[model samples]
Target: MNVLVTVTEGATVDDEFRIDGLAIDDGSLTTDLNEWDEYALETAVRLAEADLVDEVVTVTIGPEDCEGTIRQVLAKGADRAIRVWDDALERSEMLDVGAKTALLAAVVETEEPDLVLTGVQSADEGFMATGVSLAAAVDYGWAAVVNALEVDPDERIARVRRELEGGVEERTEVDLPAVLTIQTGINEPRYASLRGIRMAQRKELAVRSLADLGLEASAVESRLRLRELAEPESESEARVLEGSSEEAAAELATVLREQGVGR
Candidate 1:
């Protein structure tokens, strides 16, 4: 069985950043393979390493600038990469969950992998809804926040442990043709070997537009609009009580009383 992993080029903000109108200024951000998606890709690569799957492929919705990040995953273990981008995607204020789901569903239809893996959420937006939403759109069985996975291609089953609220874990089995949003800490991602890095340069990396994916320009038009983006205003200030432990404790108590925290 082939596995398809959804990946993204997530932005990391500098310690100090500037808000450029409705978003962080590009100059103040650095892009790399998304942390969560790295774990998902690691899971797929491990499955391939264990001979549980035929191929491990990755798909991303990003611009040409993200090819370096895509190659990082390829070097680590994905067999090839598919990147989807178009003028519409570049022009949009933001690709909402629905728009992203539509784009991914089109690729899913074309690829038709038995299993699909995605990070629990993208670091930048943290919508935490794309994987499940894509499953719904594609009519695939899915589980979210999965921390453990065991796949049986012969039986067409995938058993997973989901991380739930209150430190709860739910173990369940999903049928074949399922989507699983993998959680971090499920596995230790391996670094790319020197040989692997060299080999990645020659691997197939296909770029497709919405039209190529059998989608129209409207597929990327977001229903949601981004109106404001800014740093949150600080609500309170912290003061250091400099003294011995006992004196510091006393000062802390006095400050709490002044703020009516212990009333």
Candidate 2:
């Protein structure tokens, strides 16, 4: 019962990060293992420690520089790490779900893990589609925003409690060889120990090229094209109508009416 977790590179905007008109300078970007995926990986590690799973492996797709991110997960207790990258992939926008799903699909087929776990969304793009796309590409049943999971290896069934709208939860059972996109707060992720960090640097991290995965440059076409990027608007300022209660209430009603708002 091998469990595979997919990790993505999360990036932070540095002080030097700025937009030159519509084009952002990504050279100032600093990358790390995604926070949400860390939770997913932690869930996998707990399952392995409980003897519910035999092994835990992590996979990611990015440029050679991404090895560091993979090692970070290894330090957290993943048995093996696989990084898939190529010049073509580096030149392309990998945040597109199609290319990402294809890369993960290749890895899934090669590894043949019984269960796959992923974060609900990546930190950088936060598109929230990669996990679902991966499940579809692999033709595996999937549960999204999973907060609680219980696996019965003997029955090959997994009971999952997923978060829903209005502070509600939905419970369902998924067969083995399925996917689970974990939400944050599912568990507290463990920090990498000093010894584990040192060992991770020495661990042999496997690099898989597109060719090694039987994929071509054309095969991983990014179906999504990005347009202009912009920052979100700040929240509207709070207004304090100064005066007595009746005065403030009258002022508020007048202000609302002026703003085309009705009570």
Candidate 3:
């Protein structure tokens, strides 16, 4: 099986604030693989190790600086990594979710992997809508927030487990050539072994640009608009009360009632 893992170079809330000039400190921001995407990468690597998959290919779209995150995935066990280089994209000019999805769709079409996986959402934007959009663009079935995956390549089916409200799990089976957005806690990501790191250094990384994918700036859509960025209001300090068991219970009930709990 050939598995494709799509990753994004994202900024944290703090990083975004700093880039937008809302923060005073000019400290350089730290970047790492998105947490949810780490789960995706781990899933792909596990599948490959179990003989369920033959190769694992990781892809991402960002400036050259994104190679750090891509290299981290390669170090973890990805067979190869592809970086889509576009510096203008980092300036928030072509930052629309739909545009990004379209670019990814084009790349996936060229690669033609059996399974495509990604994080449920980027930590910074949290649009939480890219997976479905990319699937639609590529004309593939998509399952989101999948906590578990059981692939039966012989049967060409994948049984997926998703988390629902109220601590419930939803199960569904999707056919091959499907896209899945992995949820957190699906599995623990393993660190890169020395041998794996050395092997990754010899792997090939293919870079593509917007024009190479037959995309133009005018072809993208911006369904959402960003007006202004602001900091969240600081939370008030907590207050604690000490008393007898009964008094404490009563005080807790009073507080809950005042806060409109169970109203």
How well does model 1 score by local distance difference test?
Answer: 0.94
Q: How high is the CA lDDT of each candidate model?
A: 0.94, 0.87, 0.82
lDDT of 3 at 76: 91
List, in order, the clash count of every candidate structure.
Answer: 0, 0, 0
lDDT of 3 at 29: 51
In model 2, where do residues sit more than 4 Å from their true spots? Answer: 14-17, 20-23, 233-235, 238-263
Please, what are the lDDT tens digits per residue for candidate 3 over residues 218-254? 5555556566556667696777656998988889899
What's the C-alpha lDDT at position 87 in model 2?
A: 81
Candidate 3, RMSD to the unseen true structure: 5.4
Residue 58 C-alpha lDDT in model 3: 90
Give the CA lDDT, 0 to 100, for residue 224 in model 2: 75
lDDT (Cα, tens digit) per residue for candidate 2, span 1-263: 99999998888778756765545677867788998999999999999999999989899887777787888898988988898888888776444888888889999999998889999998778888888889889998888899999998999888999999999999999998889999999999999999989888877678899999999888788877766677667586988798999999999999989999984
Instruction: Give the Å shift of residue 195 in candidate 1.
Output: 0.8
Best by lDDT: 1
Using TM-score as the measure, name the better of candidate 1 and candidate 3.
Answer: 1
TM-score of every prediction relative to native = 0.91, 0.85, 0.84
Judging by TM-score against the true structure, name the best candidate: 1
When 2 and 3 are scored with TM-score, the better candidate is: 2
